[model samples]
Target: MNNFARSEKKRQHAAVDARQVLRALREMKQSERPSRVRMELPLPQAGVENDKIVYLGKHGQLADWSGGMRQRFRATRPLVDTLLEGRQANFAGLLEDAEDGVGVWACDGDITVLTHVADTTAGLLFKLLRGEYGSAPTREGAMVCVVNAFWTDGGEKVGNPWEFKLREEARDVLKAGSWEVVYCLRAVRTAAGVPGTIWRRYPEPWLVLDETGRVVLSKEGSEEPSSAEVAEALNRTANATE
Candidate 1:
């Protein structure tokens, strides 16, 4: 009664333990596996030409203009006279003779230009510009917007050196060991009849590191520095260097 009963009891206990172990293993595998997502966002249409000129007025409304209409504005004698007197327009040669047949204009912080043939697609440009601007000095954050210019080879071309005034200043903070500029790049537009059809805009704060390697200007702050702030930082550095 003792030996046989003990052997049978042990066998039943072993069978139950084996089932529990198998169940636990299956649960663990299920927990570790990534759930499959059934729904996905549709991709935007590609290879479409956006030739409309959109001007963001001082009041923040967008005004659309045709290429011919824009050219008419350029033909105005008084405006041309004023531009020549002020040396505002970089019209050293005929507009048709311009490289890549593009023009660029900046009003306050808003920029308007012709689109390029290569970088005009929206999604690719957005990703490239996001990488350049979404980085913080020592942290990570998303950008509000990034405008970019594209080279013919699908590479983002840096805008005019003057346009980089803010980025250059942000670099100064890193140079002074106060911050670090982790990312910088250009946005490209390939839409037709746009001046510079390609331009670069900074949509994110420049990443930096303080002397102690601390993050100061993070994206989550109540106050993030603007391009002007970066320019100011650069100016301070320039004065110090001088």
Candidate 2:
């Protein structure tokens, strides 16, 4: 072959090799991207605005209630789909069996979905899960507080505690019905930040039961028991069990 022809062929081969490498890199990146989980959050009776769930305030104003669930709550698509189908019995059975039945965490007096103190994301989850607005309301039930201190490094920081309210209704078959109560005790993000903006999620998103015994993400923190103190108590309980 002529020298110029040989040079042109070499250039073409190099370009093809570069294109293949780029395609491979793109595929690898796509595979690395985590699959997003769908959450089963029911909308309030107030309905949606600007593609966001909203509720009418006591003062006749509309407030956005999407909160952290929209930004932070993560789960598998199949799990969410199952919950939506009204078939969370298996999941609930798993959670019930997941924890040892050696301890009890129950609530007292009237159940309040939100502390209504600072309107945190946890508070929003409690309201949405319990159907405090336009959705179905919770019936007679018991309560359990699930505390997770993993993010706090063995309860050092003490993430928020979740109130798992178990509601009960008469049915042909017996099942567990649960809901969540929210309290704004500790700030999920203590650093300086602007209002109406979602910061990092503190503690951890956990499973809780609603009025229908369906599994849902429980809200964080509480006003009365105090999330940090609750976690400490839970730690003590774990130690005692061990």
Candidate 3:
């Protein structure tokens, strides 16, 4: 068989095996289960910034490593609990929040919501009335849903919107510590014909490309990228020569 056919066959076999394993696990009686089995997985750590790890590409396809800064979207403890409820409820809440003008960024591999802290809105208004607007509350954090896999009911590529679930294992892993979340910002034209920036996630480069293949950072494009992007790209170019 050709490489594409072989890869597809392998993926099908793996999916079948995974389903069988899940079935067997579910069928096992509580009394018959062993109590000594322990599972452990490596966790991503803070203070370990690897710019080369950032990937961008289409879902269900190979990703390209695009050097970028390791930006973390902070999330408070309470915000995480709400997102872990389930996909349906979380999605509903997302739409409701969006109606309130809350920001929601969604692309291929991930979806993020800029969640607010409880009572922050009312508290901010009260403070503003008292001329304390300078000290008003800021955006608490974001809820990030990292998509793991995509599946269709009819075995077709196109299907319903992707659902998210915080598995037990993932919950356990997240309990270890705080995880960094990155937000992608893009530039857009405002109603007044002025340039503005907004939170958006896209799978393509924000900067324009020159004739020599170098990126040109234009003022009309996305927000100013972090210096880390250039530094990391330079490091990789140097290493490639060596």
Candidate 4:
């Protein structure tokens, strides 16, 4: 069959959670309210007009539409089928899990999916094996750090402490050549009653071979060793230049 035929056949076989489908349709019923926008932004990068941006509902359901145009379109089975396919639709966070467990599409508050990504391509189950992770959202506990800093700069940065530090470090390394980009799957969660895995496109979550030949992430504050530990590791790696 042709590509169009294949796509049609796939949609014909598409299936999604029944409970999610019902809830989505119900939200559509509620979204038939009034509008509240003075002027619309017409930037494609802003995604004011495009394939839907989906958010995970409480019960692994999907909030089909957003902004002022809600309920303007029906949340039909065909729509659900298209989303399940994940091709044309813009899924900023939502995805298809190859492994079996709790993710953005979980039924309850439990998360158990294969996180061994970096190998599996699109259209598969989620699983956690090794070398890297994808994501699983569960409310275990959160952390707030009390770091002892020794600053080299004259000002404190507005973002994460790691960011300011990385900027300082990259100034020296980036002058050399290209960096070996590492692809990683960073685990993420949310407290907006919606939590799950978030696949990051940047190598900040993955292992990178730096100019000094050290494996590291740009801003994984806790995942990497402390500064003192790294100094020791580097000292050990250096050859005697006699």
- Per-candidate local distance difference test: 0.25, 0.23, 0.26, 0.24
lDDT of 4 at 52: 30
TM-score of 3: 0.18
Clash count (model 2, backbone only) = 5
lDDT of 3 by residue, 1-242 (tens): 12211232222222232233223433455354321111101111234433111112212123321221111112111223332233223332332333222222221112232332122122222232233422212222212332221122112322123411223222332322222211122222322232222221221233422212333332232233444443344344444545
Please write out the lDDT profile of model 2 over residues 161-220, one tens digit for every residue. 332221111110011112122111111111121111011111233322221223222444
lDDT value for model 1: 0.25
Q: What TM-score would each prediction reach against the true structure?
A: 0.18, 0.18, 0.18, 0.16
Q: Rank the candidates by lDDT, best first.
A: 3, 1, 4, 2
Which has the greatest lDDT? 3
* lDDT (10s digit) by residue, model 1, range 100-209: 32333221121111222122232322332333322321122211111112222212333344645433433432123221111121111112211110111122343322
In angstroms, give how far residue 69 of model 2 lies from its true place: 6.2
Error of 4 at 161 (Å): 17
* Candidate 3 deviation (Cα RMSD): 20.8
lDDT of 1 at 181: 19
**Cα shift from native, residue 10, model 4 (Å):** 31
Off by over 4 Å in 2: 1-75, 83-120, 126-131, 141-242
Question: Model 4 lDDT vs. the true structure?
Answer: 0.24
Error at 205, model 1, angstroms: 16
